[model samples]
Target: MRIKTTRQQHILRIKTTLRWLLYYLLIFLSFIIMTSGTLYKPILLVPLAIAISINNNIYGSAVTGAFCGFLIDICCGKLFGYNAVILAFFCILTNLVFELYLKNRFINYLMITAVVSYIQCWLDYKFYYQIWDYENVGRIFVRVSLRVWAYTVISAFFMYLLVKLVNKLLMPKEHLTIEEAINTNIQNENKR
Candidate 1:
């Protein structure tokens, strides 16, 4: 029994590691696609991060967010760690809020994704464009930032579905049916 339990634990750990690796691969591919010379690319990572946060624990969410943000910074050619810090912070907050206060519903996820995406877009615009006093900053804000926010929010629906599917697929199938349980109990009694 002890050996069986240990084996099961080791298998569970391997499964968990594989699941996270798949998630990271998905996010990395998403970043590549999002940054592939689109005319107006959405901040795809925001909704993705938020979706991940909703599905994961606080530590998982934070790590995923930081990973996504680090990719964003690299792709955007911005200073390192800006998006990393912001995304990690928001992901942690999202996990806590959802765990405590908010129900994990589709509508709630969309609302939270919208709010967080909006804040991220606004911060990006304010720091990169507005503060720099670039010419036609208002035009850029309207044309770029607002559009990014809208697209990010719209993409949240898909991201939420995708993450939920992944979670479902990775969930452990540990429960035994009544018949199976009874059979197992009988076998144990016979052995005793």
Candidate 2:
């Protein structure tokens, strides 16, 4: 049994802290981008929901979703707390599914994103148009169809790529196996 040196443990802690900071910073920046209206109605929320699902941290993802949803509500000028509630629910749900069955694959993300996108669009349409009676089904369908692909789908792909890249950058390298560690120590001793 080998114990890690104090310096080594300290370094590891620092690395972990730094990684978390980077991850949160990235999320914050993305939240700002989504709310700033700079992208001409980007579909950032759905992808963000999917990203939280794949994030593997229920509490953290839920919090992030809530924050982003709040920002979204502010930007859209809709009733406060509506998007926040929906996004938080989806975040928790997605995290559970990913933890139990899914492996965070791209295809899985795409399918999940598509479903979420549909739900989001429907909700937005319903709430914005106040279509409780559902009288004009044709117009709703046409509008949904046009807006679904107009920016959300493409923005989702972009957000996916961004998430992947950020994950790759922040993820720590794999730890050495016991055998590798021993070999490394032996090689270092030989050099000394």
**TM-score leader:** 1
- Each candidate's lDDT (Cα)? 0.84, 0.71
Error of 2 at 146 (Å): 4.7
Residue pairs of candidate 1 with colliding backbone atoms: none
Off by over 4 Å in 2: 1-12, 35-40, 132-141, 144-150, 172-192
**Whole-model lDDT for model 1 versus the true structure?**
0.84
Query: How much is 69 displaced in model 2, in angstroms?
Result: 0.9
> What TM-score does model 2 achieve against the real structure?
0.72
The number of the candidate with the highest lDDT is: 1
Tens digit per residue, CA lDDT, model 1, 133-170: 98889998899889988988888888888878887877
| TM-score (all chains, Cα) for each model | 0.83, 0.72
- lDDT per residue for candidate 2 within 1-192, as digits (tens), equals 344666666766776677567656766776667676543566576676567558647987787677767877886787898888888888788888988999878888877777777787677776776566667765765665446535776677777777777667655455665677899999999999
Candidate 2: global Cα-lDDT? Answer: 0.71
